[model samples]
Target: MSISSMFSNKTSRRGFIKFCSYIASALALPASLVPKIAAALERKPRLPVIWYSFQSCSGCTESLSRAHAPTLEDLIFNYLSLDFHDVLQAASGEAAEQACEQSMREHHGRYVLVVEGSIPLGAKGAYSVCNGLSSLEQLSKAAKGAAAIVAIGSCASFGGLARAAPDPTGARSVAELMQDGQIMKKPLVNLPGCPPLPVVISATLAHFIVFGKLPELDGENRPLAFYGNTIHARCSRLSFFLHGQFAESFDDEGARKGWCLFKLGCKGPSTHNACASCKWNGGVSFPIDSGHPCIGCSEPGFWDSKGFYQPIRGNVPLHS
Candidate 1:
């Protein structure tokens, strides 16, 4: 994609500026930075992204694809040069392997390495393989020259379902691999979600492409701009929660009256994310909005939590 392609055609000069403003807000950047964002998008070439999946369900990639049309998410995705993706690429076997190798060689130390799933460390790394190489080998080889690493979904970021309980494959998150020296260290960011919100995913990627560096991250390496507040802090039912009106059951009267789902095991009070604001399916609704409790899919131990319907105590904070 050309430098100006993001603003060309139907994306008028005004629309372009509006987009910059939107991204600036989404990233929690100052209003004054909008101009810089606009300039950066116009001056920089399309960024290269190499997508590698391990033990995954491919829900993360599918989430990105669900971005509403004509939105910044769609445009940013369109602007990126997706060099390699197992699910999206047409080539397979040697052709696919060669293409990936060639892209790594050509864009060494510059391309973004986007990992989509958790790594299975057991069974000689046989849990997940592509192009005849195990996930570990592929990650080790690829990390040698990547400018940065972005792990999407709870699987890649925090081991999700793959690492729960028995952990049959010795599943581990990208951060864990880094901590254990199983992979090379690099500027890394984790977008943890069962499948992260589409806007959050796109905004983080756009921030990197625009600023030439990762955004301000929290302790978990999540973009603080998006994960800064607990879901309960910004939830629409917060008033209900504060008023002690909670739905004890999915079909209860409180539920019919749009009451809080805290009694129904909402983890919103402890989980931090932009789900309450950015929402899902283009900002229409999230799980709680549908009268269900928040399962806290974005948090590290969400999958292993006591139970999705088990109420978490009071509105205490677990994230700082």
Candidate 2:
């Protein structure tokens, strides 16, 4: 069925246009492009997708699946033909592998590759294997035929906790693996977070479907529209930060008053992401709003950067 027909039966045309307008605004696209975005969704062929998981926890997948009621993420999933995702698909063993291989064959040079977790290169990649193949081996083969690749979450973007100190597994980010082995010669985008916001993922996919290109990226290959500003800039306690008022302890009076968390180990000053504006759990509240300090999970090397509870001012070593 045509994308428009699928939605038209469910809601008025005005309602669908309003939905598209919200998505366009969320993507930082100009207001004038709302109609274009709606048109693209109606006419564009459903893009094929292949998702691969590797050396870390499956928290990213969980995060993506947490999109709230009247789930827009579910709609996005329907918009694309997700051929292979081990966690979500029912097929297993040889059957699953065959489906992935078949999709790659059918959509060669056109399908989108979404990779979660990091790739382990240690012990000949014996640390993590899929269908008798190492994580890196699977990634290399899948990426060869992909038109675009999205590294979802910190694990896939920067090796995350899997590559933390002592690094036994030799876990590496998708970009690092691609660089080392000289593969995945396609547009690559990184969506980093402990587990990235579901809206960010949905909006990014929408941008790709509408524009037929990757959104603009920052130095770390993260989408600039979402990661352009530091959490501190849009933080609710920015006035406290500017006035030099801070909470010295998690439960102190200053903290109760919602003073800046910088002195209490909030990484908002250094972390760049949409958490401040987009919030989480359907725009309800994010970490800082819930009284916990920002952990800087979106940045590279956040795990080993030291002391999540240590004040960012004097104790933590700041990395760009």
Candidate 3:
């Protein structure tokens, strides 16, 4: 299923080029570069990837498995040389660990290390363990040889739920580890979400493979192309907000009529993510469109929020 495997077939070439074009559009690249991306992917060696998990629910990995725009098969079979993924790979126990170690040694300073959860420094990094090594120890070993690192969810990016107030695990993010000299600094990108949109992950990796570098990042280390706009600006309900129409309850007339959920504690106004545009469940609907208010899961410390149903701070009484 590699690009080389598809070279002899005409239909696959069309499909491959189409996949490349879709990826280009998703990454906000011009139509002109689709051929370049296709050519690069067709010839460039498959990039080595190691998907590691720590204090996570495995939701980010789950999200990527469901990626549709470029399709998970397109990414796995045609683009990346995935070396290690605990949940997906067939190897288990000691053998799996050895396989991961071998990939690190073999692809030293070349593999992309993708981490999905936060590192717990509590109890001397004993809160979360994998195999016989603590999360920190394993991360340090893998990170030393990584060309770049991708922190895949709110957990790895900002300590997430594990690092909520009165946290027992002393969970810390990848950035914090680098800052504290716990893990060596490498090119890093943080795609912060409860679980980042699947396309975002695929697009980021595609950008790296095409350009031979990471995408431009914001101050918070998110790719600006994906996280630049607040969900509110692109929300389908924006006109309702502007028109002063609000849904006070999930079952209210306004709600049924597609009015804005801002009054019902939608955090879309302040949240930065591609959900409003990119959507979920394969572009079907996001929370706001499904009669649920956003909980701002993409932002840091969201788990510590007082309540998902509580109104945002500095609320203006629209009809007071």
Question: Each prediction's TM-score against the native?
Answer: 0.95, 0.94, 0.95
The 10-residue segment with the lowest total lDDT in model 2: 311-320
Candidate 1: regions farther than 4 A off: 7-9, 69-78, 314-320
Clashes of 1: 0
Q: Could you tell me how far off, in angstroms, the CA of residue 49 lies in candidate 2 after the best superposition?
A: 0.5
lDDT string for model 1 (232-285, tens) is 889899888778888878887898999988888898988889998888997799
CA shift of 199, model 1, Å = 1.3
Candidate that beats the other on TM-score, 2 or 3, i.e. the better one: 3
lDDT of 3 by residue, 1-320 (tens): 45767564333777888878877877778999998998888778878999999999999999999998667766777778888998889899889888888999999999999999999989998888877789999899899999999999999999999999998999999999999999999999999998999999999999999898988888889988788888888889988999989998888899999999988888887788889888998899998899898898888899888888888889543320
The CA lDDT of each predicted structure is 0.85, 0.85, 0.88
| lDDT of model 3, residue 42 | 78
Task: Give the poorly placed runs of model 2, Cα more than 4 Å off.
Answer: 8-12, 68-73, 314-320
Worst 10 residues of 3 by lDDT: 2-11
Clash pairs (backbone) in predicted model 1: none
Error of 1 at 209 (Å): 1.3
Error of 3 at 183 (Å): 0.4
lDDT of 2 at 229: 86
